[model samples]
Target: MPLCLDPNGNRCSYWPQDAHFVWEKNGQKIETCVSEQTHVLADGRVHVLTWIKDAVVQDSQYCCLVSSKAGNKMSTSYISVEGSNNQDSWSRGFASWKSIISEHDKLMTNWKKTWESCNKKDIV
Candidate 1:
């Protein structure tokens, strides 16, 4: 969710690459990467996990989970991303915090559209 602008043409952006994720339900785990299929739990709940690239640094990962039950009007979701970098050092051409905030808004808009579409046919 980082964005950058540079006058020196060195701008860099964060994007998911070669991602994989798994979903857990009722003590069972299932793969859900690029398949678009939800994992069904023993209690008839649907769960999914998604992964995205965390940052430019190597060995970074981001994951999210969403769960829903039949006849339930609400669902639970969680997200987490992790990475390690030298805190004291500075990296040039990195996106500023402000740029990241702006990019987050844009990402949220896209996510909202996907969420609406996913729940569009659900029974209220």
Candidate 2:
């Protein structure tokens, strides 16, 4: 699945060629849910509605487990950060420029105030 991130956030999931040189064929599976008590099961299947709020880096692995009377299997996939990189990069650049401009404006205002105060003879 593709992971979504806000603009200006450097948290990207770029696929590193070196990282995948060695990987396990089958990995452990994890369940996604809030709590067992909150889980709703119908017809031997679990159905739940939940929202996950957090931040994750690109290429983060997510695993899921499938179980049955026959046997159990595991599946894993990585989140793609390319989706947010380009878009967020531009946004972050703009935000950085804005911060710089704000700082410049504050410096100029202080300089002007100091200049005016010095002109009045009371300023030493």
Predictions: Cα RMSD each: 30.5, 16.9
Superposed Cα deviation of residue 55, candidate 1 (Å): 42
Runs of candidate 1 exceeding 4 Å displacement: 1-95
TM-score (all chains, Cα) for each model: 0.22, 0.34
User: lDDT by residue for model 1 over 1-124, one digit each (tens)?
Assistant: 1233233444322212222344443334545433443344444333443443222343322333432232222223333323334432334325566688889999999998888887896723
Measured by TM-score, how close is model 2 to the native structure?
0.34
Total backbone collisions, model 2? 1
The residue pairs found clashing in candidate 2 are 13-58
Q: What is the lDDT of residue 49 in candidate 2?
A: 28
Give me the candidate number with maximum lDDT. 2
Location of the lowest summed lDDT over 10 successive residues in candidate 2: 16-25
Give the alpha carbon lDDT tens digit for every residue of 1-124 in model 2: 1232224343233321122111221242223332221222333232322232325554366554434344555556666776556777888989999999999999999999998989896776
